[model samples]
Target: MNRLLCLLIGLLCISCTSVAQKEKYKKEKVYTVSKTNAEWKEILTSEQYYILRQAGTERPYSSPLNKIYKSGTFHCAACDSPLYESKYKFDSGTGWPSFDRAVEDAVDKDVDYKLGYARSELLCATCGGHLGHVFNDGPRETTGMRHCINGDALVFKHKESKNE
Candidate 1:
């Protein structure tokens, strides 16, 4: 039927548009810790490679860092650059480890339209590793922003006690 044919055509157009929008931000950049693809593969695990290099996201509420509440710092897994402080972290209940802010000059944000909408995409300023997204919802008493990050992209270091 002509009705069925027209409906199919309309669906196809929508699919094509969505695909095009997703790839709009796929261009590569020169990172501070630039390495050959093979070199990066050797240095990082398979999951880290997928998220940091390919801009993939980890499963929500799946990061051990989400439950971490110790006094310490979180560094980029790729380059070991300090990115966040323990004081800024909070439970946003959005799965990932959410922070109210990053350390000064530690992260660089860019407009990401991968999901067909604009979002603040956070990256490691030192290595350009994709951390996650930042949003406006956060502690009103503090920064009023949430830096939702992937635990796979970070390595947490607990502060040493003076008594020890």
Candidate 2:
């Protein structure tokens, strides 16, 4: 019985070490647009602060950007970093705005175990704001990767027509 107890304690220690390392990495990583929680709250709406700063998700189908099909760029609402082009946007029927791909180097990815499983979490490279997750299931004709993004974490900028 003591041997089994020792093994269990060893497993627990390993798990705790990994969790501490992840927390250390998060605190050490710096973003170009880093700001304090109070400062972020001052600039972002409550929903935006929740989604971007606290990694909270907005309710599905609640974002107007989910249905926007206009020609434009979807930028990080926290830092105005251009992320997804409208050409890559698609209706995944998942309620959130879905994109086939993001603009090159505009976003970063990390593993998320928040839902008790590993998921690819997407973040704004410029600000480290949590945008959403990427999945393997997407249109096969394109990148075959669906970047499921939170519309509340984005700001859509309409592309300018040359007519003006």
Give the alpha carbon lDDT tens digit for every residue of 1-164 in model 2. Answer: 99999999999999999989978877555789999999999999999999999899999999999999888999999999999999999999999999999999999998888999999999999999999999999999988999999999999999877863
Q: Which stretches of candidate 1 lie over 4 Å from their true place?
A: 1-29
**Which residue runs does candidate 2 get wrong by more than 4 Å?**
1-5, 8-27, 162-164
Candidate 1 residue-wise lDDT, 1-164, digit = tens: 99999999999999999978877876766777888889889999998988887888999988899999888999999999999999899999899999999999999988888998999999999889899999998999999999999999999999977865
Shift of residue 84 alpha carbon in model 2, Å: 0.6
Instruction: Look at candidate 2 and give me any clashing residue pairs.
Output: none
Find the candidate with the highest TM-score and give its number. 2
lDDT of each: 0.92, 0.94
**Which residue pairs clash in candidate 1?**
61-95
lDDT for model 2, please.
0.94
Candidate 2: 10-residue stretch with minimal lDDT: 22-31
In the order shown, what is each candidate's alpha-carbon RMSD?
4.8, 2.2
